[model samples]
Target: MTTASSVSRGRSGWGSTAVAVLLVAVMLFPVYWMLNVSLQPGGGGAVASPWLPLHPDVSGYAKALRDQGPHLLTSLVVSLGSVVVSLVLATPAAYALAQFRLRFTDAFLLGILVSQMVPGIVVANALYGVYSDLGLLNSLPGLVLADSSTGIPFAVLVLRAFMATVPGEVVEAARVDGAGELRTFWSVVVPMSRNALVTAGLFTFLFTWSDFLFALTLTTTDDVRPVTLGLYQYIGSYVQDWSAVMATAVLASLPAVVLLLVAQKYVAAGATAGALK
Candidate 1:
């Protein structure tokens, strides 16, 4: 016993879903092409590739792993490092912002917002001189610090948003139970804000793992290059092997893809955690 308007709404909903699927396919075409090319035999992908890899090959992946393995490891280390540093700094800051009233708090937040508006390249160029003076230029630590500049502010906002909703009574109860600020933060607030922490950390990892500009600007040597830099190594003045290059991209994408899949629920919960509450 559906009305005409309800049937029209159902048709519109199907139309919207179809359009969304088309948009997703359009956006993911490049990724699909990359995988298709990577599976072609004998580096036949240098010129052109078929839509489907009727004849699959693992040589490109083998070559990519052989050549880019170290860089992949480097990216993993830098990404993990950035996450640790960002969360360490951001967690306390977010807690203070959400739980305490400090002077110039609004102004300080405005500053962070403004800093985000500033271009990354400008920040990179500025850090170059400081890094050179401190011997941080071309080092893993430097990359971690530079990448954390992006992560910290973002992590603070996300964590603060979620932490702001923690019931004051719950926090007070923890305090009345003889828990100190540090203990309460660690045992009570942190466990409550788990989803936001995961969300922030996942984004930080993704950012540092995929960072190219910072890798290109802060590092000049192969000693501590990330996979982003190593992937760029395949392309030069002469483009000889496209399959290996595409293969490296596919391999590099795997970690982030797997991480997103694993953390998808936490990310969703974090985003909508306090909305209804």
Candidate 2:
């Protein structure tokens, strides 16, 4: 009986492993195809095999980087800038919401959550008008502001939940030592919530980096246009260069992938901590 049971368990384990491998392959096929197409050398109306590149070349990457001009750089700048600005502004606000009991605090928090429900496209026309009126159209700062409006609420909510997990005793002790609110927050609360902060920043970075609608509608020139818009430009009305499009797509996805890989541990920890608390 024991031997029979062991054999059955072994077969079950093998079956599970096979299924897992198949699932992974299915998920990864699209990414493989994207890379394959990106490396292929062919223009529109050129029939190229999808599985393998007929003429593998780096011209697509070169075009994406060089001929594409400062758009990639502009995207990097806007994404990084928006994340930093949102984190800086959101952290203290979150800390306040988490730690203090202000009048209408609940209402304020609700308002922030409600703002996220408003679709970006619905407000694009109004925002464009506002940007034009303020001379902020086609401006980096304006783009940052537009992205931040969406980013700040989530940042605030996530960091606030993380901040709530911190022991109030630690904060009280800091205040007893004559530390002011800012000092206590800087030295005490900030350090304890580093994992949460990193998680929030990573989330903000990914959202701002991937944003296309806002970036396209708000900015007019290549100077402020993000890689999303730049990639869109490759697809013309009459024809589309699939290879270059795939190459740009791969390149645009790299930063978010790297950021997630690096910060995954913190993200997990922050999530677990928030849930347990």
In terms of lDDT, the best-performing candidate is 1
Please give, for residues 61-87, the per-residue lDDT of candidate 1 as tens digits: 898899899999999999999999999
> How many clashes (backbone atoms < 3 Å, residues ≥3 apart in a chain or on different chains) does model 2 have?
0
- Model 1: CA > 4 A from native: 1-10, 274-277
Q: Least lDDT summed over 10 consecutive residues: which range in candidate 2?
A: 42-51
**Alpha-carbon RMSD, candidate 2:** 2.1
Q: Candidate 2 — what's its lDDT? A: 0.83
- Lowest lDDT 10-mer window, candidate 1? 233-242
Compose the digit string of candidate 2's lDDT tens values, residues 12-116. Answer: 999999999999999998888888877977464324545777668877777667645587787788888888999899999999998998898899989988888
Error of 2 at 189 (Å): 0.6
CA RMSD, predictions in order:
1.8, 2.1
Q: Each candidate's TM vs. the true structure?
A: 0.94, 0.92
TM-score of 2: 0.92
